[model samples]
Target chain A: MIEDKKTKILIVEDEMIINKMYAEELRSQGFLVLTATNGGEGLELALREKPDLILLDILMPIMDGLTMMSKLREKDLYGKNVPIILLTNLSASEEKIMSAITKNEPAYYLIKSDWDLSQIVEKIKERLSRKV
Target chain B: MRSQIQKKNFEEDLTNARIAAQNVLEDLDIEKTKVEKERAKEVAILLSIGDGLVVTDENGNIMLINKVAEKLLGRKKEEVMGKVFSDAILGIEDKEGKVISLEKRPMNLALTAGTATVNSIYYYVRKNKTRFPVAITVTPIVFEGKVIGAVEVFRDITHEREIDEEKSEFISLASHQLKTPPTAVKLLTERLLSGKMGTLTEKQKEYLNDIRFSNQRMIDLTNALLNVSRIELGAFTIQVQKKNACAIVQSVLDELEPITKGEQPKLKTIFPEQNIMLMLDEPLFRMIITNLVTNAIHYTASEGEIVVECKTINKGETVGGKLLKENYFVVVISDTGYGIPQVQQNKVFTKFFRADNAREKHVNGTGLGLYIAKSIMDHSGGLIWFMSRENKGSVFYAAIPMTGMRTKVGT
Candidate 1:
């Protein structure tokens, strides 16, 4: 299992700087990276590419991450079953996120302001391993 | 200025006076003098208002300047008595020492066109040559079909205006600063977590996840502040058009879907008609509904059912007031969420107001959401209110007037 091929990850983010930073960091973990600028395009690509894991930004133009996630869930097609993590800097409503994690149970809920690169990679590994 | 009716009546009186004079038996002499004196006293009473009062003649020369105007404009009644009203009244400048809207000056048009309009004429300059802010209303006084003079009533608003502006600036600066650090932390964390530096231990990953969660909340607060200020300045306008109510609800839910997860509340909407064409502001209505939904979600227990209903109703019947001429088209959002105490319901509309209980629970509220929501409804010619009990949950309603139904109630 440890010697298995690296998982593919798709990051849907609005900000250019953050998207690049996320892609760069994930790639260094030996994971293949895909990027999209908005939730609409992200959904289109996710449906087509079928990435193993998804890292989505909540605040994005052209259909935000949350809406895209629901659409993917409702259809249960393409990359619909992939483990997804919500990336945001918003600090209030931890319970909302926690409950969401427990239910959709994203591999890990990452708050951008507090988590470091090392921590996020660990989450990706942990989530990938804890399959249903 | 005299209304057309008043001018017509005065002309009629003049004709009667000529007829009475020919008889030489009527008491027109004493009655005529009495009427003029009474009118003068009435004008004097109007002049005595705390606001600056100035009366200008046909040529814009200052016919009268009250005490308040004397102090505010740095000119005495004698000094400004015969001066041009345009120069004296228009002399007032804004806080930045530049003239505010020239068209905002009511006296300018009133003096020329015999039109009465209330405007914020500036008497902002202080007695010591410093600038203070004053809001003035100018109305022309006409008699016998001619504008004899114009009266300007003005008030000093130096302190209030300054404070309001200062508060706005502070909020803007603070929110901007608050957002920067969070963005930076979020950026760097994403870098480290994605393993740019090196592989992370399982425990290290858990800790980072925690850090990320807390940071998410900080961002939400900053965003809330941005919304609060936008609403306060009365600029949170909406796109008004005929739209399907169901479409808006679906979008909001879709927007909130990720958070809805397992505890996904049973959300129901009664859109009796598919093309019911809601004549309202979409973006603004979106904000209002989104905020209330979020509040309900936060307060309600997991898996609770929430009902959102829309129906047109007549409001005046229950309000029992002559003021409410017509009923309103309304939408009601009811939640099986934690209910608010009865005592605090009345205060929900106040700016930045939060219930003590809600605060105790550490609810991250700007307290401005409901206030802004109420104000939005108010200015939109609609009404927003809520009914709740200790454990019975809450029902929040918004009633928007249809078409021309929402006339400006009163000034």
Candidate 2:
């Protein structure tokens, strides 16, 4: 009998508790989960491991999510094609996030406070299932 | 003898005429001095003005440029006098940094339209090409029903703009910080309720749900406060795109299904068969519809009905007692609920205002929803109004011009 490979997800968030909560939830949902405390580490992990999808936060300490996404997108075909979902508490009306979404073409932009962990898992699944 | 007498009389008469001529010349000199003094006083007044002032002739020529105007423009009065006003300015840009055309210039608009125009979102470029924001007021100098010229008063608004930006930045930062903990609580509670951690009794599940609900409310309050700050500061950005109005309203209704399920008021929608496409900021539009529909659901009784309708209205059509001036895509939300008191109708859109009857009902409300909705409508070049009778029901109308909302760039 052959074992099926689980879909992998990388969560790049600065807040320790939020990162842990999301990772736990996704792990419970039967996916391999990787976590990074900031965008710099996230980018490094993403380039090395090449997760199926990346969950990025906008306001991180070292390198913000947008800058990291831009660098990763420029790296190679794998980095460019991977789906990245932006998770932020900032209002969608923020010009910086709006323009970044337009430029980076993130899979989805979710407001953290407005969404549930279950709903987020559903979104991730939907994104992964879609054709590239 | 008579000829001698006549000659002497003629000489006397000539001497009298010469004395009268000298008196007249003396009076003329005194009057000239008085007139020159008055002219000097007027020039002193113009030069002493604190704000930049420019006077233009009917032909749009710079007649006079005051001291402050010269300093602000980085050009001396002697250099710019008699030059075309728009040409002499060189670079005048709108809020978006786009060069304002000659026809759109405030001075020219005032001249042509014979009305006063006030604008604060203009950048004036100095001789050295350094630009600064300016708040300007231009009024046509009309004399005897004829426009002779215009008087433009402007002041540098760099300090005011900096303060406004600081305020907006502070609110945004504070709101983000305030929301983080609530978000954590919400997510953690959801994780507990997911039942993967451990088996939970009904009581435990109910308690966890309560915590989640309260946390969500805190998150909502923080968001509402942030929105109010943005609206008050005029710092909200608007991105307009062609969108189906009916579809947007329907989406709002769909999102509210969770709250409207079971024994809640019957939700009804009346949309035109053909989609009404209009330019709108989708999220802002959604926010507006959500606010109105939620209010309708909250205020109406469980057995009552709430209707959401969308239709296109033409010019001269009357809505909410006001005659429309142009084509509009309107959404009407009518509810069979506790209507606003007649006296309180005027204050419905004001900030932090809840009706006496609504407060008595004890339904949870911030009273900021309608105010925020109205502000969004005003900024979008739209209209929001309502008609209600106490103890009967209310009909709220929100209309956006068919041409669409004007895109605004702010914080």
Candidate 3:
């Protein structure tokens, strides 16, 4: 069926409902999806799977997304080059968020409440297309 | 016989002179006692002042300091008296924790400029190496048209600051928590409406759409409340950069185009041939423009028109009795909509103030957009005002100084 050939995406979110909903939507869109409830688990899965793209949430238990992203970026060439999009409820004007975005090159962020699920899917697709 | 008469006259003259000298000495003693009483009273008044008070001489030397000042500075009166004002009370820092330069110290400014300076965003370090936020006022002491020294009064605002920080923290946390449910609902509703799970009837779809709309409104209210809290706390950071004014306005218009589509109001724009480069916080500038335009659209009828014009003016005009002077990059948003009633015009920028007409026309407004916008403008060294008649439309004007927005490093 060549199901294994589909592009893989990893979602690291602490909220179970949101993670499940996103996973369902992306799976229906014909992408292989992996989910992690926290940053530590997300980082381990990301390193092992080497997914095409990572969707990260900033505020999480057992290590935050930025910490994990930085650690992953430090791991190897594959980690440094992978596309990571930060999805959070934090305002972009926040000092911490702004600084983190500037430091993490080639990273994009979307305020979850401000963006619709469809728009987020569209953004994911746009990022994947650009990577290709 | 003549010698005896001369002796008697000489003795009488001597007695009168002696009496006059004794009376003069008594008067001098009484005057000295009164002066001492007045001086003691002045000293008592200075020592009893609630706020920390320090008086300096023309050369910025500390002349007198009250008991409160001594306790706050963690130094004895004998130790700091006659020392340089700024040096005696060392380690003054700005809100960013940067040490204040000598030239920028309020006492120095008051002494040099001969003006009163009041500031609340400063921290003072005590002798024990402990620091606390302070609200300080320094006034130049002038006598007979000559600039003397300065009088500084300060209070430790640690308690007030703690309360404010707690309030802001609570609001931020509450707003985030409040938004999460709405976000989940919005996403789930969108997923259900996509019809990937099952085929839905028209009525079901319509009901889901209503749910989504209401959920979106809840999210908007949360955001607005958060912004208001930030404004009240003076915690919003402003990073100023030079950007094209026209381009910023165009971008806002583009973002609002989706809402404008299929709406009754016809949106139009007028831009100068040459784009004006203004120093502004781009996001904040965009927010101001968006708020005004959105309000215009919401208030105006479908058959009405909305116009957004951008231009540069060498001199500013007074609108609604507020004078906006100097060179400015101005944006004027005018709409043919239900205007605000004249009786309620003054309260347009107040929090939670919706005019009777506005509440009647638009039901979902949180009445915070203009208040937040006005606070931002005031912080940015910009101006926002409008004129409206009950029956006619309203015109809102926002002016940004050519010099640029005031950059603030805030939480």
Candidate 2 iRMSD, 1 decimal: 0.8
Q: By TM-score, who's the top model here?
A: 3
TM-score of 3: 0.87
lDDT (tens digit, per residue) of candidate 1 on A11-105: 99887777787788777668889999999999988888888889988768889877778777766655456889888654323344545556564
Using DockQ as the measure, which candidate wins?
2
For candidate 3, the docking band is medium
Which 10-residue window of candidate 1 chain B scores lowest in summed lDDT? B402-411
- Interface RMSD (C-alpha) of each candidate? 8.9, 0.8, 0.9
Score chain A of each prediction against the true chain A by TM-score and list the results.
Answer: 0.85, 0.94, 0.94
Question: How close to the true structure is residue B348 of candidate 2, measured as C-alpha lDDT?
Answer: 94
TM-score of each: 0.52, 0.85, 0.87
> What is the C-alpha lDDT profile of model 3 across B99-211, one tens digit per residue?
89998998998888887988888999999988889999999999998889999999999999999888987898799889878888988998999999799999999999999
Ranking of predictions according to lDDT: 3, 2, 1
DockQ for candidate 2 = 0.82
- Tens digits of lDDT, candidate 2, B1-411: 999999999999999999999889989899899999999999889878899999999888998889898888898888888988877665799766789988888999888888788988789989998899999999999999999999999999999998987887798789999999999998889888988889999999999999988888888888988998888777788889999989989988988999999978899988864598889999899989999999998888899999999998899999878799999999999999989999988999998899999888745688889999999998889999999987788999999999998788884
lDDT tens readout by residue for model 3, A20-39 = 88899999888899999999
Q: What shift in Å separates residue B260 of candidate 2 from its native position after superposition?
A: 3.5
Q: What clash pairs does model 3 have?
A: B264-B302
